[model samples]
Target: MIELEGLTKRYGEKVAVNHLTFTVRPGVVTGFLGPNGAGKSTTMRMLLGLDHPTAGDVRIDGRHYEQIRHPLKYIGALLDAKAMHGGRSAFNHLLCLAQSNGIPKSRVAEVLDTVGLTAVARKKAKGFSLGMGQRLGIAGALLGDPQILMFDEPVNGLDPEGIHWIRNLMKGLAAQGRTVFVSSHLMSEMALTADHLVVIGQGRLLADTSMADFIRENSRSYVRLRSPQQERLRDVLGQAGVPAVEAGSGILEVDGARSELIGELAAEHHLVLHELSPQQASLEEAFMQLTAESVEYHAHSDTGPPDTNGWAGGTGTEAVSGGGWGEQWAREQRKRKAGG
Candidate 1:
């Protein structure tokens, strides 16, 4: 298990990571999520003792990383895929790491095979593609056969196959009772991979909860209704003490009312209902809603001309993608409404 308590880090006048406290438990994949420059990398560095925290402490298995002898045997991390020596062959690279760490040479081949990089074992790392590089990095992390593993953006530049492989690998590791903590900007991947989520914005902890709970708490739930007499239906819904908003022509978004209640009201009013569906907000939308103000950088258009298409490619677009950003979001939404 990894436990961070009141962790804080600063660079000159800027605070990189604020006073944050969270625990990543074992036997599950814990996702570390945030926008760019949210101090995720900095936090990981502090955990690994690469950078000293300004305050607070981080502990792995009840001990600080620096205090633990043979740290690699206890914790394995792939902080940077490109941190390896480019001139060295994949096998040679792991061999050197093993030799220095007292790991047997045979273990190097075992890890290389585990990452499916045995075919390119003798190839120079400089010639490997981004996916191959990631595989090699993962191989090195597993070289020690550690019980705790941390990966930062393992699928950043991977193809679909590579991404799938990593997802399964992480899940498999967690299933084996290992602690798997991975950081990524891809909410979609995290939704499928993580059992729990730790979200931060501007270096402050925004949430630390189960993935389902986070989405359920952050997303707005509404009942979607459509009728031929839309205006009358809207009035009926409003009179029933439910908040209603016009989602589109002949469609109303109703909140604070269950589907059965809405249906009963419609039947009582003799409304010609064309459609009645419930809509729950997506995780991407919930994330945007929660962190919209905390976003560190904001882009502005020049010439004072309004960019009408700005929202089209920005957060708005992300919110509309639905399952693309996180399948767990959509699944949870379905489960909530289906419970009715």
Candidate 2:
């Protein structure tokens, strides 16, 4: 297990990572997610002892990363796939890492085969494609056959087949009871790959939960209805005490209502229904919902204003926009007081 308790990091006047406290357990794939400039890479570097923490502590098992001799034998990391010397051959690169960590030269060949770089085992790193370079990096991480594995964007530069291969590889490792923690920008891939999630935003721990629970808590589920008789359908729904929101494209959205119930209602009213289906918000939607304010970098999009209902809520500064919960409550009070 990897444990971090109140882990923090600072760069001059800026706090790169806040008091992050979490445990990465074995036998599961834990995905790390964050928006741009969220200090995800900084936290990972601190875990590997590549960067110093300003305060707090992290441990590999019970020992600090620096205190663990032959640390690779305990935890293997692929933080940067291109961090190797370009002049060295795949085999030579693994060989050097093994030598430094007191791992046997024979293990180098084993790992090269494990990552399917045996054909290019003798090729120089500089001659390798991006995909090949990623494979080489994965080979080095697996060299020690450690109990804990950490990967940052392991599928970067990989083709579909390579992505599938790497996905199965991580799951297989976790199935063997190893701790598998990875970070990725691909939400769809992360949804399929991760069983657990550690989400951070703006250097603060936003959420630490299972993938299922996180999505469920952070997203909305609704039933969509469409019919040939729009006005009649709306009246039928309203009379039945079901709130049907008139959505765009001549559709109605009913929250907290089952599709079966909506269908039955349409049938009872003799309405010719064209469409009725349930929609659940996706992982990408949930992640963005939770991290809206924490997003450090902003890009102007033509998209409309965000739906601030679900888990996103609103920032404290949203009072300026009359969106914050406290501001809304105060506004309600003044209206009641002034008889507006």
Candidate 2, residues 156-214, lDDT tens digits: the string is 99999999999999999999999999987666888999999998865789889999999
lDDT of 2: 0.82
Candidate 1 C-alpha lDDT tens digits along 114-203: 989999999999999988999999998999999999999999778999999999999999999999999987677788899999988768
Best-fitting candidate, scored by lDDT: 1
In model 2, where do residues sit more than 4 Å from their true spots? 246-250, 293-340
Q: Tell me the spans in candidate 1 whose CA falls farther than 4 Å from its real position.
A: 227-229, 270-274, 293-313, 317-340
Q: Judging by TM-score against the true structure, name the best candidate.
A: 2
How well does model 1 score by local distance difference test?
Answer: 0.82
User: Model 2: C-alpha RMSD to truth?
Assistant: 8.9
